[model samples]
Structures are given as structure tokens and as C-alpha cells.
Target: MRAMTYDTYGGVEVLSETRIPVPKVGPGEVLVRVRCASVNPVDWKIMAGGLDGLMDVVYPVVPGWDVAGTVEYVGIDTPEFTAGDEVVAYARKDYVHGGTFAEFVTVPVRALAPKPASLTWQQAAGLPLAGLTAYQLLTRLDTGKEDTVLVHGAAGGVGSLGVQIARALGARVIGTASARNHDRLRELGCEPVEYGDGLAERVRALAPDGVTVVADFVGGVLDTTRAVLAEGGRHASIADHTVLGAGGQWMWVRPVGADLAELGRLADAGQLTVTVAKTFPLAELAAAFDLSREGHTAGKIVLEV
Candidate 1:
């Protein structure tokens, strides 16, 4: 199989397309013939050694985690899915050589979910990590009813999903984005606020009582998660750990197949939607990485196998 990989962590220069052996199915695993792979910020972070503290990697690393494909074979013990099932999943636990950039990759059966019929392979490929992150932050935190929520980086993948999920759950959502994205955020059922020039004040103008929960997808110096959360309210970040030091307690996004399936249902029902800003062939994985690192993608970037 031809796959893209890097023998050392660095820039896109280190990435190369080469032939590698196809992965084999294990007792509890399924072999997926990958059709598309999605890029995430964590992909580049890991490539640059930014997440070495949390995840260790071997050389010639294959960095993709989000995969959309068909199950070509299922292990004897993997009864949840069978060959010919179309699936989408986050394959982080296969981190050592989770080669989503290849024609085939092996993942545990529990990680796979039936892909939504309404989404194309590229669109579904981008949903596993970002979509699941949004789902867990709101539903797992019990953020339903008339609660008010703030979403930082609302134009980005996870942030955009968080805004829509909050609104779907009957929450009043305030999302932070650039002036250009204000209209787009409004279309997603959110009150959009610019990221700078006193964001807290802008959100206050919308809901003076303060937001009950904050979902920060941008974990930089300007992250206003602490400022937006109501007193003693919950703050969750899908990005870096800056939110951990915020006044409110921080929550981490964990992958849950049940949660992802619920999100899939929303997508299939047209109650939830996602954007794919760009798609690259699997051989151009290096360029895909560069595009994701640019940090201004309108939606998720995908690599088609």
C-alpha cells in the first residue's frame, strides 16, 4: 500500500509518500479500506512534537486519526460490524502506526460507527474528532434547557459544531469569530461576537446574566472562556490547556461511540451539518498538513485516499 509518513517530527518537508505494508486485522479489530482521512490541529501538534507530553510516537509516524472508510474485514470476535459496512471513526488508540493516510488501516471494532448516509466520505471523515468533541462538551456536561453557552473560535470545526449543538439543545449560544464569519455563525443559530475588543462585554450585551457554560476551541492568549462562564459555571476546552487555569473548572473531550452515533443521527436527519473547506488526495498529505496549520480554514480539511 502507498501511504504518507514522516520518519521525524518537523515541517511538511519531512512527510513523504511511499509504499508500506497493509495493516492486518486483529482479534478485536476491523480492517478499513480508507476512502478519506481528516486533518486536525492535533495532527500537526503531534507532528511538531507539541503533544509529546501526552502522546508518544514512533518514527515514520502516520499522523491521521479521523478516517472514513468501508470495513473490508472484521475479526471473528468483532460482532458489532461486518465486512462491507461503511464507517467513520477516530483511531487514536492505534497511534503508533494509525495509518489513515494509507489505503487500509486497522482499528478496534468499538471505535467504528456507521457513517451517516447524508454525508460524503470527506465530510464524514472530518466529523469523528471535531463532532464528538462538541457533543461531549455540551451533552456530557448537562448543558441543556435555557442555558446560555459561549463558544470560542466559532468558525472553526469544533467551535462551529458546538454552537449548533448548543442551539439544538435549547441553549442560547454566543460564538466568537472574526467579522467575516459573523453572518455564517448567525446562520448556525448563534449570536456571533468578534474575538477582540472586549468579547465579554459583547456577550453581556446579548445575555447580561453571563453564559452558563463556555466551550473554548481556541486555547490561546485571547481565549475568553473564563470571562464568559457564569460564576461557578463549567468551562471546557477542546484545544490547549489554557482553559485549565481559567476560573471555572476545565473539562476534557473524550471519544465515546454512543455520543458519536447520536451526532451521526443528527447529521442524517439534517438537524446538524458540517463544512469541508478543502480536500486533498492521499498523496498530497503534506499539503493537507500545511493547510490545516494555516489556522484559518473555513471548515475541516480532508485527504482522500
Candidate 2:
């Protein structure tokens, strides 16, 4: 099997395409013939050693978490799937272990879910990790039609789906994005608020009572978000905010298969969409990582296997 991997944590340049033996399925696991894999900021973060404190991946680790693939083999204990089932999953490879960046990967059967029928492998590849994050955060708040929620970074991978999911849940959605995506946000049923230059004020002009919940995928300068939230509002962020004040709840998201299943259902129903902004072949994994880290991608970047 061919894979792009790094022997040590460093910059993208450390990544190299090498011939490695394909992973094998163990008990309760399935071997997947990868069709596509999603590139996420965490992939770059781990590659650059940003998460060394939390993950102990051995040297020469592959770096991807989201996969949309076909089951090529099944482990003895994995009865739920056969050798030809299509699946999409958050494979938990960011920290250590093999990942979807290769021609094949072995993932726990519990982590895999049937890919949405409405999506190609390329689109479904973008959904597992980011979609699950959005699902868990929104559902945690129990937000309803009566509530108004603000989604920061509304045009990025997770935020894009978050906006749609909020609307599907009947919340009044206000999204912060660059003016370029204003129409796109509106299409997702969110009133677009241009970020920066009095972002809170802009949101206030849209919702006089203030946003009752906020999902901040972006970091820093969240005092404005605090002001936008009504008292007792909830805020969820993927980024670390050491100085965030206590006006509302703050949390970090963890991957949940149940949440990804729900997201997959939404996609299958044509109620959600995964936008793939860019794609690269497995050989160009380094460029894919660079694109994801640039912070301006319109949607998820993918690695086609």
C-alpha cells in the first residue's frame, strides 16, 4: 500500500510518499479500501507536533481521521459488515495508528457507518469528523425553534454544516462569515453577519435580544460573542480559549459515532450537504495540509485515494 506519512512531527515538508504494508483488520475491525479521505486542521496539527501532549503516535504515522470507503475485508468478530459494504467513518487516527491516507486502512467496526446514499465518496469523506462535531454541539444545547444561535466561521467545513444543522433543528440561525459567503449563508438558512469591525454589533442589529447560543469554531476576540449571547447561553468552540470569560458555558468537542450517524442520516435525506472546496491525490497530501491550515478554504479539503 502507498501512503503519505511522516517519520517525525514537523512541517508538511516532512511528509513523504512511501510504500508501506497495508493495515490488517483485527477482531471487531474492518479493512477498508479507501476511496477518499478528508483533510482537517487536526491532521496538520498532529503532523506539526501541536498535539504531542495528548497523542503518542509512534514514528512514521499517517495523519487523517475522516474516511469514506468500501469494506474490502472483515475481521472475524465484525458481523455487521461484509467485504463489499460502503462506509464512512471518523477513524480516530489523528493521535496514532494508521489512517485513511493510504490505499487501505483498518478501522474499528463501531466507528464505521454506512455512507449517505445521496453523497459520492468524495462528499461523504468530508462529513464524519466535522459533521459529527457540529451535531454534538448543537444537540447538546437542546436548541429549538424559539432560540437564536450564532455560528462563528459559518463558511468553513464544520461551520457550513453547523449552519444547515441548526436550521434543520428549527433554530433561528445567525452566521458570521466573510462577505463573500453571505449568499451562501443565506442559502443555508442563516442570516449572514460579516465578521470583524463590531461583529457583535452586526449580530445585534439582526437579533435585538442577542443570540441565545453560539458555536465558535474561530478563536480569540470572543468578548463580542459573549455580548451577543443572552444570559445563560452556551458556547462551543473547537479552538482553545484560555481567557474566555464565564458568561456562558464553554466546551471542546469530541468525536461521537452516534452523532456522525445522525449527520449521515441528514445527508441521506438531502437535508445536509458536505462542500468539498479542494481535493488532492494521495501524493499531494502535503499541499492538502497546507490548504487546510491556510484558514480560508470554502469547504473541506479531500485526499482522493
**Which model scores highest in TM-score?**
2
For each candidate in the order shown, give its overall lDDT on alpha carbons. Answer: 0.82, 0.84
Estimate, for each residue in 1-305, the C-alpha lDDT of model 2 and write its tens digit. Answer: 99988898799879999999888668988999999999989888888888888878876797888899999999988888998899999999535859789999888877888888999889999999888878877887787888899998889898999998998888989998999999988988889988788888988999988888888777675787778888777776666454245544455555565677788888877789988898899999988888887888898899999
Off by over 4 Å in 2: 93-95, 243-252
Candidate 1 has its poorest 10 consecutive residues by lDDT at 220-229
Q: What C-alpha lDDT, on a 0 to 100 scale, does residue 272 get in candidate 1?
A: 83
The number of clashing residue pairs in model 2 is 0
Number of backbone collisions per candidate: 0, 0
Q: Of the candidates shown, which would achieve the greatest lDDT relative to the real structure?
A: 2
Q: List the residue pairs that clash in candidate 2.
A: none
